[model samples]
Target: MPTCSAHAVVDLDVTGATISKHLYGHFAEHLGRCIYGGFWVGEDSSIPNEGGIRLDVVEALRALDVPNLRWPGGCFADAYHWRDGIGPKQDRPVMVNSLWGDVEENNHFGTHEFMALCELLGADPYINGNVGSGTVQEMSEWVEYLTRDGDSPMVRLRKANGRDAPWKVPFWGIGNEAWGCGGHMRAETYADLACRYATFLHNHDGNTLYRIAAGASDDDLTWTEALMKAVSCLGCTSRPRGLFQAISFHYYTFAGDGISKSPAIGFTDEQYYRTMVKAADIDRVIAAHSAVMDAYDPLRQVGLVCDEWGTWWEVEPGTNPRFLYQQNTLRDALVASLHFDIFHKHAARLRMANIAQTVNVLQAMILTDDEDRLVLTPTYHVFEMNKGHQDAVSVPVHLVEAAPAVTVGDQELDPLSVSASTKDGRALVSLSNLALDTDTTVRLDLRGRAITATRARILTADKPQSHNTPTAPDAVAPADFAVTTRPGAHGSTELTAVLPPHSFAIVELDLA
Candidate 1:
């Protein structure tokens, strides 16, 4: 039997990074039911809807305070002709989603629909332009269509269709995954093409387009260097801040080879440990890429955008393989919490991260059935619980001899992971106990901040495979957490929390 008791001290005075709200962002591509049935069900559907979009989904997303939504594609954006999807639904062109699924894309939910949905959710829209198969003129016209306030052909067309006013699209991706599905082009070639497309992508309606060049996949430093160099050369004779403000990086956590990933539920303990290790690799990826960016832009003028991330598992049993839909479980919640902790720790280099998807897709926050029933997955609760870390000043914490490692075969993994933030006289601490059999008692010493009140919300289960289904939707959900506290000798508050195995928790403290 292993006794899982850990002692750690957190200093309130030690603070550095300011966690951007965008770190809690989400991604929605034109893939699977993520767009069609998952979000857009048409105004006449039997399901309760608001302007063709599901009102239930909208309200659920609003609860997360979803910061930004990347749209038009994952691989779909590059081949997507925005013009085809923008007009009367009857007149819209039908196209095939070649990369995602071989199914037909009924251009019903196009530019206007996406922007409208964003407005309803109060989330910013991050559009990925088609640089792979699209021309510079096409990209320019698309931006002009959505954002141009002055008189223009695209604007005239937009007005004739419906919307009288132009929308403000702040974040723009020159291309997505240029090293792979985007174009299969080398770094230098893609960089040149990105510069050309970004050149014609102008600022519209007093809205500065924050252009992001397609960036590295994993630790491919050359990709980062080449893109940075290209942008730097363009910046020398161009504006002081140049065109591209950020670089996009895409990383997905799947341990198995190729598309054959681990199962979504009921995996061995060793398999679970390996999955957690792969999830934590984002920190290393960000650090390596940031160092390359630092070499070129030492002022950290450009930030890193983890536009595509999340666990990709084998599709749900009998569904279309290309749909990329998988059930969310406690493992996913832990993985999400780990990524958020890493993102919060590296807030300086990382400005934003949009999980691979939002609904009915890879590691989705919400899962829906054919009967219009919705289940808030374990990952959803993690985001809802840790939402306070958004835009909050990140308080650094050091774990001192807290607990031993969980040894599985040749791998060693820490049992406790934590991240702290301070906002409005409140200290928010997010924790994860990563062991499979032991529940660790974490003794927290709030060094500089005095606690007046404390409350915690935890997402856990009796088993690692515990999850929500339509039949049992509340199988693994958040519940009130109780902690023991006492006044320490040095006028510090000592708090003791029992973190169960494979659980994620958010502890909030009101400071006096």
Candidate 2:
């Protein structure tokens, strides 16, 4: 392979647009430990739980300031019947989670439990409706059960289920992965189903529910264009409004053959670079999709929600592969930061995004063992570092100098992912050196705008192949950064730090 040379300015000032609150959203599915041991511990378990929702997991998520959480599945959403999860736990039939494992989904943790958990975390609930095996009335009644205070059949059932009033869940997904998991419908077919479902979703609070339509995979431009035209004809512009408030998109970073069930922890530079290459495409995917949306609606009002994203590999050997479990390493952490930088690159139109699974499933922010829970993956640390960009406006900056290129297999990747944000006269820039083989010297040209170095954090491991275990949790912990200031030409204040191979870093600066 030939060496690639590049120097491009990342002017964050390109658009002074604020990001939507949905950008900080996350997803949780009915896969493996994500539910049973991850976030929900039944009343019989020794784990301390509030109505079966694990207290430790909820506490860990609160620290990250988690904005929203989508329940119940990626594929599970289509099969789940909300009513079965309500009423009486004993009377509710035990159903098989065919989408995940052949395990029984004992209806112990129901709708009320989830709402109670979401309330405690202060994170809004985004429920993906079952369009594949459900009805408009069922979806409508779910909205009523959660959002309506009136005396309806669902509300009556909710009261009987031990809840006095409705639980307001503002964000509702019309469907999930219509092209694959959710019945694999054509765009036109899914669009029609979305129109019907969205029509029945009652926005009780008057706040328009963020009704997200299922979108395309990777570069399926046709899928997105078809949906946009469908929405246009479906009629949100007729003043009475349209069924869709947002159009959803899904993407994942998988190494090797891209088929799931890849190994965890012990990976080569080839696998690491391939993962980064996949992650780096998030921005391009959003941009290209947004352009298609613009052709139909110039205002760019339709939101592009990246609902399912993260690193996917096979589960640990003895563990269930369908569970989608893999260890979080410094490599995964950098991938998280890289995607955040990409999202900020298009903050204007790319309103909401969510990582695949929040705990113990796929790309989880936190993992669990028995009653004890830990922030397992590098993705968790990246969220801690980039929390500032959660709901902040994108203040673009022009990135200068030639960045080293990393290549593996047949793909090439940029070593650094850069994004900037300005608020209250302070310009904060986050740059992640995503190279897994070596550290690159990152020179930030702030133009003499000196600010107090507000401490830096680095997440690394003793070995590149290290994985977190029950006995050793701190194998990859953050350390006091080597923050050295450098004097540069033309009002430029440069700072240098070592971003470990397959690691992540963040620098905070104030404007002069």
TM-score of each: 0.97, 0.92
User: Where does candidate 2 have its weakest 10-residue lDDT segment?
Assistant: 1-10
Q: Pick the candidate with the highest lDDT.
A: 1
Residue 10 CA displacement from its true place in model 2, Å? 7.6
Model 2, span 1-512: residue lDDT tens: 12222333333244477765567788988888888788887877677887788887887788788899889878898999987887667888899998787889887666887888789889999889999888889888888878877687777877876888667677888878889989878888987888888888877755457788888887688778877887674333442246787888888887755847456677876777777788887778888998888777667777788888888877867887678877777677777788887787788788888888899977788877653746555677678767766666676566566566666667677787777776665555676766555666665555535555455777666455665666777676666677676665664565665565666677666555
Per-candidate local distance difference test = 0.87, 0.75
> What C-alpha lDDT does candidate 1 achieve relative to the native structure?
0.87
Cα shift from native, residue 51, model 1 (Å): 1.8
